[model samples]
Target: MTENGVPILQLSGVSKSFGAVQALTKVDFEACAGEVMALVGDNGAGKSTLIKGIAGIYRFDEGEVLFDGQPVHIHSPRDAAQLGIEIVYQDLALADNLDVVANMFLGREVLQRPFRLDEAAMEESALKTLDSLSVTTVRSVRQAVAELSGGQRQAIAVAKAVMWNSRLVILDEPTAALGVAQTRQVLDLVRRLADKGLAVVIISHNLHDIFEVADRITVLRLGQRVNLYKTAETNQQEVVHAITAGKLEHVPGMASL
Candidate 1:
C-alpha cells in the first residue's frame, strides 16, 4: 500500500534471466485499484518478460510480488487467475469455433455433479453480465466468435475477464488490431473497467490510448524502470526521452554544455 490508505499491487526488485541473456533487472512497479497504469518501452526492452513473470508464466529469480499486502507465489496461469489476475492478450484468444458464451466459459465451465456442463445456468449468467456491461450489439452469446467485429470480440474478452471476478486485468496492446472506431470502443471499455474499481495494467505502444486511459505511466528502458509518474506530471516528449535515452528526466546536474 502507498502512504495513503489505497491498496496496491507491487513487484519489488524483480529480475529474470534466460541462459546468458538478462531480460529484466530489479524491476519495481505498482498498480492500484481504480487506476490504469500504462507500461511503455521499445521492443526487447523486457516489458513482455516482466509481464510474463507477473502472469505466472515465468518465475522470477529475484524480488517479490505482492497483491494487497500479501506476498504470493503465482507458479502457473491458473494460480494467477485464481488470484484475480487476468490477461487479455493482443490476439484476444477467442476460439473462432466457439460462440460468445462458450468462449467466455471456455475452461471454466459451469457444471453440476460429475462435471456436467450446465448450459442454462451459464447462458443466463453470461447474458446478465453482458447486459450489465451494456453490450447490446451482440445478437446472441451463441454467435460464433469469428462473426463478431474486432470491437465486439474485444468486448467479449473484457467481459469474460470481468465476469471471472478479476481484480487486475492486464491488456496487451488491446487496440493494436482495431480501427479508429474499434479502438475508441475498446478504450471506453478500459475506462469502464477502471471506473468499476479494477486495477488495470495496459501494455501498449500507442501513446494516444495511454494518455486517454492511463492515470499513471511506468517507462521501461533496456530492462530497467526509468521513471514512474502520474499522467498529469509528464508529457509525450519526456516519456520518449526516458524510454530512449534511459533518463527519467532532463536533470540540471549535467556539465555546462
Candidate 2:
C-alpha cells in the first residue's frame, strides 16, 4: 500500500521474460476501490503481458501481488477468480447462440440439485446483477447474445464479472470498434462499476475516453511503468508525453501521477 491506503489490487517489482525477450520489466501498479484506473501506452508496451500476469495467464519472474493488503499467489485463471479478480477482454468471450442468462452462468451455473440446473434461480440472479449495473438496453434477458447490440453485449460481459463478486475488473480495449453512442454506453457502465465500489482497470488507446471516465491514469512505456497520474491533476498532453517519452511532468499522488 502507498501512503494513502491499501488498494484493492497492487503489483510491485513485477517482471516477465520470454526466453531472451523481455515482455515486461519491473513494474509497479495498483487500483483502488471506487475509481477507474486507465492503463495507456503505445503498441507492444507490455499492457497485455501485465494484465495476463494479474489474470494468471503468465507468472511474473519477480514481484509481489497484493489483494486488499494481503500478499497472494495467483497461478491460474481459477486462482484469480477465487481471489475475486476478473478480466474482460475485447472479444467478450460470449456464446452467440446463448441468451444473456445462459451466457452469464455459462460455466458456473447454479444447480437446483445433483442433476438439475437451477434455471429460475440463475435467471433471477442474472436479472439482479444486470439491474445493479443499471443495464436496461436489452429488452429481455432471454434474448440471444447475437440479438443484442454491441454495447449490450459488452454490458452482459461486465455483468458476468460482477455477478461473481469480483473485487477487481480489468477491461481491455472495451470501447474499441464501438460507435459513439455505444461507446458512451460502455463508458457509463465502466463508471457505474467504480461507483459500486469495485476497483476498475481499463486498458484503452482513446485518450478522450480515458480523460472522460478514468480517475487515474497509469502510463506504461515499453515494458516499464512510466508514471501514474490523477485525472484531475493531469492533462492529455502530459499523458501523451509519458506514453511516448516514458517520463512524467510531475507525480500527482501516492495513488496516481
Per-model TM against the reference: 0.92, 0.94
Per-residue lDDT tens digits of candidate 1, residues 79-198?
999999999988999899999999999999989778689989899999988987777778989999999999999999989988988899999999999899889888988988887788
N/CA/C clash count, model 2: 4
- What TM-score does model 2 achieve against the real structure? 0.94
True-structure RMSD for candidate 2: 4.9
Candidate 2 residues lying further than 4 Å off, grouped into runs, are 1-6, 248-257
lDDT of each: 0.85, 0.89
Error of 1 at 45 (Å): 1.1
Cα-based lDDT at residue 155, candidate 1: 92
For candidate 1, the per-residue lDDT at 25 reads: 74
